[model samples]
Target: MHAALTFLLLFLMAGTIVPVNRHFRQTPGGIPVFVVSNGVHTDVVVPLREPQTGTDWLEQLQQPQLTARFGSYGYVGFGWGSEQFYLASYGGNFPKPGTVLRALLPGPTLMHVDFYQQAPRPGKRVVALQISRAQYQQLTQLIRASFRPDSTGATVLRNAAGYTPEDFFFRGRGRYHALRTCNDWTNATLRKAGLRAALKAPLAGSVLHQVRRSRFHAAAQ
Candidate 1:
């Protein structure tokens, strides 16, 4: 009987261990969506998977498939990794190079909340970025303002704020990459503020091409 009990315990332990480890190693294809007015009024949505380009994943989720059944005022972005892991003081240990997480835009109400890391992946590699309703408007405005008549340099313009010409796009473990010119800037800024080690690196000149803007005609108009 004692031997039997020991074997059961061992089996249970192994069962728990495998899942916990698997979640940590799995690459995040997308992120959890939330519409929270504060810590109190919180509505949680399941992780949204990346959809094919031109498909509006956000609107589809907002309808009823999302458990929370909440409405969003904007779309927010961030990174992810294991929850309890410690992130490097600087931007070291982000993820394997070249992975990118892409979420289709719905409207503006969705805000970027904290990135969730499920389990054992080390170094808190997953990251999150949150924005208030006002911030979301400002971001969309910036994107529109910086948008050129041609799409040729739009990517650079989206990422140019506070970055030198050399700032190129990189990804974390969960396939998260910056979409616009300021996305990288915003991520780097958040990392600098949240993690001690995320250093500001020089941007390559070509990278700057997308970011340079003359002015927002909307302002003058």
Candidate 2:
């Protein structure tokens, strides 16, 4: 089991919808952002660069080794969670007994950032949204703020390699606990960015359902 995929926690899975900003028109011209999920986990994926603004994230994202290995990546997916679960999520195994128990308590957090080669497609496990330039900046700012600062007051990317060369872990802000889960962080990011998100999303199912329902509603309109 990959952690919480099978856990029987009694957290709230129901969530309410927050309408997208009235000023934030859902037009094709808006930047395309994607929320991807792996049933148990969710990631907020964003563009690597905005040609119009000439905003290059490589400098701020710590120039991941992926650039050296494969030139450059098109998109980046940011995830925050317990360091124990993240480190133990190597190969196919999830956290063991001790790891799981410790994760229940307030522990250090890490950002599991992954670089994508192509644009993420919106499917059953992916919800795509078109947001304004301002919204995109806001979303990115929240994500950036989650990174823990190093001694030099900069976001520190761990020297340790990731599951793949394309992804790496960074110290994260805030503590990971039973109440503020990975999915909860994801939900908070969206809500902070002034997007349509659930009222409560401590579980992946809760966040996924809210996003899917919002997408359906938008499509039906």
Candidate 3:
């Protein structure tokens, strides 16, 4: 009961925004990044390469399996969440009560990665943001550290299939619970990159509201 009450309070707090963030200006031709949500969970979408620094994100992470299959992919979406709940929810199936209870406590987590053929259009549930070169470096560093590396310093892949054929699961650092969740991780990544984000993003709406501008002027084709 305590946990349930605490969760409810946090959810309410998360829904109430203190202040909105000043959206970034794309006039400088900064690298394009995205904060995408399914109206529930959030993900940080980054290009495979840092065009300015020539940093190959896939190579730095050494995602061999992912690289082998999606070498030509344009962008990748990274999300962190509770393993059981994420696995159950990824397929659009409702997680069991036991899984929900377990997730409320600190538990094992997973990195959910999705590759994109083209950049996602900025619309509802997708907020487009641009970060400077230095910010991109910080973003990569933050995300790279999230992957649980092995003795050889390579990220360990989970022995499980993903909801999509191309996406895959990987061991992620940190524990996930009701207080700190997938949305929190997304907000943290954005904050670390010096981008606009909520101070405490316990829900997808929390983070999305931070980066979303009142008007979205889609780029010219």
lDDT of each: 0.25, 0.77, 0.80
In model 1, which runs have C-alpha deviations exceeding 4 angstroms?
1-123, 151-184, 187-221
How do these models rank on lDDT, best leading? 3, 2, 1
What TM-score would candidate 2 get against the native? Answer: 0.84
Top of the candidates by lDDT: 3
Steric overlap count per candidate? 34, 0, 0
lDDT (10s digit) by residue, model 1, range 39-158: 111212223332322323234323232223223322322322221121211143433332212221211111222222222121122223233333333333332232122244222212
- In model 2, what lDDT does residue 63 have? 58
Name every residue pair that clashes in candidate 3. Answer: none
Off by over 4 Å in 2: 1-11, 16-25, 64-66, 215-221
Best by TM-score: 3
Candidate 2 Cα RMSD (Å): 5.1
Better of 1 and 2 by TM-score: 2
lDDT of 3 at 60: 70
TM values, all candidates: 0.20, 0.84, 0.86
Compared with the true structure, model 1 gives a TM-score of 0.20
- For model 3, residues 118-192, the per-residue Cα lDDT tens digits are 898999899887667887888888988898888888888784468878677889999998778889899888877
- Comparison by TM-score, 1 against 3, better one: 3
Model 2 poorest 10 in a row by lDDT: 16-25
